[model samples]
Target: MTAFSAIHEEHESDKEDFTPGVEPQPTWCPGCGDFAVLKALKGAMPELGRSPEEVMLVTGIGCSGKLSSYFESYGYHSIHGRALPVARASKLANPGLEVIAAGGDGDGYGIGGNHFMHTARENHDMTYIVFNNEIFGLTKGQTSPTSPKGHKSKTQPSGSAKDPVRPLTLSLASGASYIARTAATNPRQAQEIIAEAVEHDGFAHVDFLTQCPTWNKDAKEYVPYTDVQDEYDFDRTDRREAADMMYEAETKLHEGEVLTGRFYRDEQRPSYGQEKRSTGEMPEDHLAERYFEDDPEFERVADHLIDRHK
Candidate 1:
């Protein structure tokens, strides 16, 4: 099997003890955005008023994916770009769980981009946090999907010619119920936004601008977390206005002039789980049993195989 599949299989058997306390120290770089994101999520958990068992953290392959092991909750460290799908399925299976999907720009916007768009429109009751550092740190500093054009990296030594993907704008256009932006340096703001996202009833997407000191140093120096200020027209809730703000912030060339705050929140649409329950189908308490009973061919094959083995 592939290395990724092996890691996932190993993770399935490794059960972490769920104890209540401060979040464990992270293994990321000293100034990495992941540190702040982890802190923010840890701080927000108390406000959520949910037990560790009630929350589920799912993450894709990347720096942010390590978050699954840091939190004192049920966590799924899935394959690259598959965090959202696993998180969505978990939430559907147990609608009471507060599911959150975390990953880097490459994992979410590149490999998981299609799933991201569909989940937003479906309005799943979950929160998606993308740590966008513009470059792939794990792969020895390669240009990622969100890397700015002309930014030099290991993959593009002469600077990339393709324009970076604007995650906020794409999220806005994807019909996300809630959209927000924050800098990983601003722990307070990140905490607040994460709390709000968990509280949001529909699909929530937060684009967290993270700094990768190892890669994209130029961009990192340009937008130091402390340099950014929470600036946005909070009074504007119109979708068009939010879309405009997302575009401007993404395209603006000023250093540390990026806006940070909640851009959009719409609670009009019902979540997928809610809509599914409305179909009048009785919920199955024993999914495993139902699966075996509904497929006689599989059951018979399994019995025959067991008999032959015996």
Candidate 2:
């Protein structure tokens, strides 16, 4: 298990373990791909034997933000493009929660791009799933960072002149230790990829391709997809090979050929948490537990900080 693994009682888990007691029905439109993400995520938890209490899901503002509400876990529905910072802070504090940050393309690649890049560069111990529907589904179908060049939208009535962001390539260049892409159309693969990402020790970035039927009418349904693992042979650990594959995959997507699968993985690199601990910068004891310890030393340190600040 990685540094992020929680010390929970080992037992069998089921998909239903992630379902809330109240179980509010999903409001996503019929045939919406976000539904597939939710279903696949639920299916993945049991494979890792993770209970709801061991996980933390943080989401940014968007239709995808509703994920925090639906999933039964310690969840935070954060403001637009801010889920990463919150997830990062939580993981650093506890170092035991299985933190997962989520957001739509606009929420992540557009407004949260800087945070995403730096988090990956630092090799944060968490999984980040970006729902790449190309266009912003919420806020009335505006053009997003991942929107295809020449894509017509409410914000770009004449057609967007900017090229789509290559997420896989960006993740690799930004120093993510694990990188993968999966589409909602392939639920089994999506579930498998999510499980792998969660288990990875370093920054794991999964660019999830979802279709927005209500807004992105011209976008492909992400059907007839090619799983790179099954179809192509390459060394995922080799930066050059991974870069080549990611570039090809990014190019093919806008050209109407959908390719998805793991592109890069480097397990040897230490996660940010591990580095902090090794340097004695971060306390070995989980910070979240310190508040309940009632130790005199802890109070003395707290009082010293408060007095210094005053």
Candidate 3:
């Protein structure tokens, strides 16, 4: 197993434990779906038996990025569309930390879109929470990548002609080991889904359909939803079946029928860290803990360059 911190002492952790000591109180506009995500995440942490010290939350720029501040865990407020890369580095350095990367749809699926696809492709052992509000909430509601076709906005006053990105399908095609869609409207399912994603060993992507009443007034409130696992017959482990279900869900999203639940999971696949360790590439101990080691590769390389300059 990957050793995160040798000195990290385990203790009983509760929901309140994840509440930051000194940070902004969740300032999302009233009725903003971001509240539900925070709540579900808070609830999921205690369920995982994880302490704030054991978890790390990395977020990108945007309203959703505020999660790092509100969360009590070790946090990183990375730049716009860059939470994933920062999170990836942290996880690679210390895999024992429960790494969670969160960002708004625009921050995640727009400029950071390339990072999202590749992170999933590598099957990184981390939970990625994309607040799919379908628009950029912080930037005054512009037409985001996930905005439906013909969607009107300050950026697209004539209604956007660009087709919305099918995040779940894109996630699947990118090779995420676990993929699911949840919404702020369904807290119970959201909590359960988040918890499951945390427990999953490989890349877990949760497309959270959050509402933005302050903006995107035309966006669906994501109410009266149906959980595919509870109501539909599909194999989560079967790629073809999962793909079919995701297609329907992505289609019905625009048609006003909200479908949410686990769409795909492949537990058989090994996580990036695991693969590296198995191949003798990843050191037994975390790289972060070796900074003081004598003649570490980095120091050796620096010494080589210095001698050449001399």
Candidate 4:
């Protein structure tokens, strides 16, 4: 059988026992933004009609990192600022799997900042969800990469001096195929954005503005809610317009004036999987056969490559 055929058969066999069910109760604090994000994810997963076995959820260190344990799917709770590499490797290893990389702002945009930029440029087929709560909740409320200036936190005891990172603008600038922003409080909108991200063929990222009541009680002036309506001129889809909006939003702290929606999408770029296939590589089953039939020297090389690297 072809490698693709064998992998398909394996997936089919695994799906026999797969069933959609409620996710485990989250371990986040009450009113945590992660809770709403988790709920929106659960609501979106079933709509995709994908079996749990076909899905792989990879998360990073932080309150959002705990998501792997709460979902009923293949999961990996990776180290801090490392979810992107882990998720990228997972997708490359098993291209058939529907991979979703998730983490908090601290884990994704802070220390893991480099991975975010390259991953967007790579245009891999995966959905990245960043719950941007502004502060590092898991580390006991330290100022995160997206923490705005003057926002006090454990790390920034006297309020942050530097401006916060604008993730949406960065993603757009980094050539992300799909980019979006959403608020955790708006569950319906969050779910829709996530669903769209999942359906997008290339690297898709959703920056979710989540609330951190524990650390950001005073930073409520910047948080977005479903009920609040602020005047935003979304009249243009040009890149310059998007960049301007990002700059304006970051500079001016207007209450109830957050923009939440798909900011950019480019479907022209080929996904990593498509590129690999186009290069005439054998399908999954053939690759597996090659691995199993290869001599011990090749086996040793494979072992060394996997063990010594990454």
Candidate 5:
């Protein structure tokens, strides 16, 4: 493993550049919304001029976890609900690497909820995409955190007594610099939002509504949606305004109305890495490359110096 260095050759690339050859077709079921996420993500990378080598995708265990295998990039299919920690470390190790963490709602908003809050609060420079399918699709449709109140599943056969989580609002409250919601139903919108999220400087959260058609039959395909930017006019940079807007969107979503698009953006705040660098806490030389001679060329130089001194 190349201990997560970011320097790479920039070149022309396309969506096909990210697709793996000789890999099995994605196992997502017919009409599965996970396809939209893959498509949008593939499209976003090309448009952002990022090559597969320049990106690091970290994913947690779930149907979404398989995404790392399909996308031809530096990837890690970590254990359940632990993608964020792995991704945060990778980004800190290689600040220039475009890091994207992905997982299902249960894996992210439920099991890894604590990591999610702290990561957002610290404003790590990376993108976290939550596949909000409303239920655990790969695990036989068990009721999940975002599942509507009264949503019945194998775990909650009669009906779920818990209310769904307000993910977007929670992202805001946790101090995420950029927050948005996009559905797999709208591929173009999903692509645009993902591209923007990838470019954002701080913790960018996209609560993606990817429907599990095979398991979650009740979730609205997330269409007939409203883009907060285009339909509901408001200043995206305003914190209080963004909070109010997120609250409304979260409330309406469970009521069967799909609200998608950018909710909050704060370009002024520095990312965690940037803050450390500004405060002189970050060393001038990358620790992995300098102290450890992790770079091949650096190892050669050290070996030559030792021989000369002998």
Candidate 6:
């Protein structure tokens, strides 16, 4: 069978399919919120009927970056804050691959902020999950972009005077077609949100509130989080309503009131890949399939190069 077809072969899949046999154990600290993301992803894969081979898990440098090692899939451990770009390229090359990028607040919202904004603006077909613990967990509790104003950390000893980045609002402003927030303390909701994000055909951003118990001592475990869909009556499909609701949720998070759920979705818009293909800029065939399939143009180029070298 061809490489592309082989990986996309139909089969009965379970959560175990996403677990690496050689490295099944994760070294994350006990009570670490990163573990919840791993669980939610593994759980969501089975529900989506997506085998590990059909998925690409890209992660950036951070405690959350270890996800690539634990999950059995086409994994890429990119440099700090570069996960989104890598994921975007992979999805563009192989539109069939289910691409998911993951990183911490520092890696994504801070260092990778530019890429994140543009990718959403273009509406790339992929899922991005940011582990927002308010502080940089991997770098020993430094003040992150999402850190609350006046929040003191080792890096911000005098308490940070800058306000935190509102991720949901920023996502909406950047034109992300799908946006949501979920907490590590609520695995069921996290899994559900992940499944929905994966099913989305455009840019899907999930601001996952993961408490870093080891570094963030003052941050709560994100418990008592209310699902906005269950508690509030807001039209998630309406941009104005979603914006207002997201603003309220962002404000509430700092005030110790946690609101979690799908905040926005726009299904009418097309994904980046769709736009490119519609414009005849991107090919319908998967780029990786070139090696498995014969093409006269590719052969002509190869032969010309070989003759010149010889």
Write down the lDDT of every candidate, Cα atoms only: 0.78, 0.92, 0.92, 0.75, 0.90, 0.93
Higher-ranked by TM-score: 2 or 4: 2
Question: What CA RMSD would candidate 5 show?
Answer: 5.1
Candidate 6 lDDT: 0.93
Candidate 1: residue 109 lDDT (0-100): 95
- lDDT tens per residue, model 4, 89-163: 888777877899999998888889999999998898999999887788877888888877787777778988998
Task: Please give, for residues 1-310, the per-residue lDDT of candidate 2 as tens digits.
Answer: 3333445768788988888877568888887889989998999989998988889999999999999888999999999999999999999988888999999999999899999999999999999999999989989799999999999988899999999999999999999999999999999999999999999998999999999899887776888899998999999999999999999999999888999999999989999999999999899978767655545245456788899999
The C-alpha TM-scores of every prediction are 0.82, 0.95, 0.93, 0.82, 0.91, 0.95
Question: Cα miss at 304, model 5 (Å)?
Answer: 26
Error of 1 at 206 (Å): 0.7
How many residue pairs in model 6 have overlapping backbones? 0
RMSD of each: 8.1, 2.9, 2.7, 5.1, 5.1, 3.0
Q: Model 1 over residues 138-211: C-alpha lDDT tens digits?
A: 87789999888888887899989998898888887887989988887677888999999998988999998888
**Tens digit of lDDT per residue, candidate 5, span 5-40?**
435556789999999985737988989888999999
Summarize candidate 6's per-residue lDDT along 1-310 as a digit string, tens digits. Answer: 4678846567779998999988999999899999999999999998998898899999999899999999999999999989999999999999999999999999988999999999999999999999999988877889999999999989889999999999999999999999999999999999999999999999999999999889887777987789999889999999999999999999999888999999999999999999999999888988777767654235456788999999
Residue 87 Cα positional deviation in candidate 6, in Å, after optimal superposition? 0.5
- Residue-pair clashes per candidate: 0, 0, 0, 2, 0, 0
Model 1, C-alpha of 282: deviation from truth (Å): 6.6
